[model samples]
Target: MKLSHALAALIIAWFAVFGRIQAVTLEVNQGNSTCIKAELTASFSITYNTSNSTRTVQVPLPDSATVDAGSSSCGLDGNTPWLVAVFGPGHALGLSFSTNGSLYSVANLTLQYNLSDTSVFPEANSSDVVTVVSSSVGIWAPINTTYRCLSSATFGVGGVTVTFSNMRLEAYMPGNDLSPAESVCMADQASTTAPPTTTTSATTTVTPAPTPPGTPERGVYSVNNTNGTACLLAQMGLQLNVSYFSQSQNKTIQELVNVTPNLTSSSGSCEASSATLILTEGRATTLTFTFTLNSTSNKYHLSALTLLANWSDMTAPLSASNTSLNYLRSTKGRSYMCNTEQTLAVVPSFSLNTFKLQVQPFEVTTNQFATAEECQMDQDQMLIPIIVGAALAGLVLIVLIAYLIGRKRSHAGYQTI
Candidate 1:
C-alpha cells in the first residue's frame, strides 16, 4: 500500500508532534491584570504527562477569571495533570495541547482586561502591557508556560470614578502552584454621635418662738426725859390728870416733896402753945384733908371752917372744946378752940386735945396788937403756913385785911372805937 501509507503518516505526524512536545504546562501561578468591578478570580495550573494513555485536560482563563478545576486526573505516564479552566472578562487563557486528534496547544498565557471603561479591554495603562495576547499563539514557541499576574483595577484616570460603598474583599491562594495571589479592599467602619448633659438643686429653711414666766416683792413704834417733875398726879382730877401729862414724855417721879415753914413767936406774953402739926401727901392721894383755912382763920375764929382739914371722907361731926387756961395766945380776945373730928386722921389729932386756953394778954406797943397776932398764927398753919408764906405771905394778908376793914369803918364813924 504506498509504503504502508508512509509509515502511518509518520506515525501520525509523530503523534502530533509528540503531543505538542509533551504539553500540559500552563502556569500563571496567579493572574488578573484588570477586570474586577465585582466578581473576579483567576488561577493557573497544569503540569502534564499522558504517554501511556489517560488524558483529558484544559485550563484557560481571563474573562474576568474564575475557576475551580480541582480534583483532576490525567495520566499518560504519571506526572499528574489536568487542572482546567476558562473564565470571564476580556480573556486570555493559556496552556493547551489536546489529544483527540490534537489542535489546541499553547503553553501558558494570562490576560484579563476591562476595568469597565465601557469595556473592550480598557483601564490598564500604568505601564500598559497589562498583558494582552489572546489566542494567536506561535512565535518561536515563546508561549512556554510559567506566569503570575495579579491585578485589581479600580484606578481612576481622566474621568475619575472610584466607588466602593462599605466594601471588603480579601483573597489568598496557597496551593496548586499559584504561590502569590493576594487581594484586600476593605472599608466599612463607622459610628458617632454626642451632646447632652445637665443637673442642679437648692433649698433652705428656719423657725423659732415661745417663752415667759417670772414675779416676788412689806416692814415702823418710838418714847424719852430724866426728871424735873412734870407733875402728874392721876386720880383723874386735875383736869383729868393734866390731860395725860406728856411733857416730852418725862419719866422721873421719885416722889417729890418740898415744904418749909418757920414762925417762932412774934408776940407772946404768957400764952402760945400750939405746936404739933405735920402734913404729908406729897404724891399719895385719897384726898379728903389737905389743909386750907386762911382769911386770918376767919377773923380770929368765927370758924366757918374754911377747910382747915380733910383727910378724905371722915365721918363729919366735930365741935368740942372746954376752955381752961393757956398761954397759946394769938387772939382777937382770946380765941383758940380747935375741933376737927370727922374721925380725924391726924392733924396731930388736934394736939391730943387737953384744951386749956385763956391767956390773951398782948400789948407789945400795939401795931394793932401786933398785926392781930400775926394773923392768927398764920391761919393755924394750914397747908403748912401757906406753903411757907410764899406768894408774899398771901399778898400781905390780902392787903392787910382790906385796910383793917377800911379802918374799922372809919373808926366806927369816929366814935365806937
Candidate 2:
C-alpha cells in the first residue's frame, strides 16, 4: 500500500508539470452587417522600454501559435477585434491602448483595457480585437514593417478577415475615445499639398506620411448609446497627428493640425429620456439622440442630427485661455454649419456614463471579460489524464511487489529441497 501511494504521487506530479494546455472555444457573431463580433483567448503582456520612455503591449497570438483557431463567421480565425488596445495612466494613459493590432509601440504608462459587449450590458469577455481611435508616439521593443498608403481611406478594408488591402489604420490623441473634435484618421489622404500656382490637371497623389511610433489623429465622432440619457458631446482642438500601419517598421503618418478656423463651440443637455448636444466644429456636428431602443431594429437611432461643431481639444493642459475656450465658442453667432453631411452610423449599444459628462460630452465603451485569475481548471480537463497516469503507476508497483515476494518464496523452496 505504501509503495502504491508513492507511485501514485510520482505520476500525479509528472502530469502536473508536463501536461499540455489546450485552447478554449468562444462564440462569434457577425450579424448581418460587416461589423464583426467574435471571441478568442489571449494572453496579456506588458513591457516598458526604459531606453525610449515608452511601454509596449504585445497581445498577438503567441509565437507558438499554429493557426487562427478559425471562426466560421469569417473563414479563418485570428480575427483581431476591429481594434486592439491597452489603457494605462497620465496624458499618456488612454493612448497606451490603441490600434497597433495589440502591439502598442506608443505611450508611456501602466496598462489596462476593457470594453463591455455592445449588446450585453456588463457581461464581458476577453477578445482578440478592440476598437478605438486614439494613440501615442515612441519606438518600442523592436520596430518592423514598411510604410504604404491606402489608395483610398473612405472605403477602409472591413470584413471578417483583416488583411493589408482590407484593413484600416487609425490614430488618435489620449483623452476621450469618442470626442467629436477628437480626430480619428481612418481614410487614405493626399500625399502632399500643391501651391495654388502649381495646380495640376490630374488628381493629387495619395500616400500617407508613416505609421511608426505613431501619429495623433483628430476629427469628429458620435455613438448612439444603449443608455439614452447617458450620451454626451465633445469638441476637440484642431491640428492633430494621424497614423497608418500595415506591417513591420514601415508606417504611414499624417496630420490635420491646420484645422480651418481652428476653434469652435458646443453645448449639451440630458433630460427626460433623451440627451442632446449641439456642436459647431470640425467636419461633422449636431447630434440629437433617443434615450430608448428602436422597436423595429434592435439598434438605437439618432432622432435628430446635423453636421456642425466647434473644433477644440480637451486633453491640452488647461490654461486661462484654453479652460474657457469651449464655453466662448458655444455662444457664437449664425449657428455655424457646413454643407457636407456625415454618413457614420451611431448604432445604439453599450456606453459609458459619468458625472463629468453631465456638463460636457465625452465618454468611452469598455469590454467585459472573464479574467485570467477567475478561470478555473475543470476536474475533467487535466485531472482525467492525471488520474489515469496515477492508476497505471500504482498497478505497476503492485505487480512488482508481488513478483518480488514470489521470487523470495521460490528461492526459499529451493533451499529447503
Best by lDDT: 2
Q: Rate the local accuracy (lDDT) of all candidates.
A: 0.24, 0.28
lDDT of 2 by residue, 281-373 (tens): 333222222222233443222333222122233211110000000111111111111111212222111111111111222222232111111
Q: Give candidate 1 misplaced runs (Cα > 4 Å).
A: 1-65, 68-89, 92-111, 114-167, 171-187, 190-417
The alpha-carbon lDDT assigned to residue 304 of candidate 2 equals 33
Against the true structure, candidate 2 reaches a TM-score of 0.20
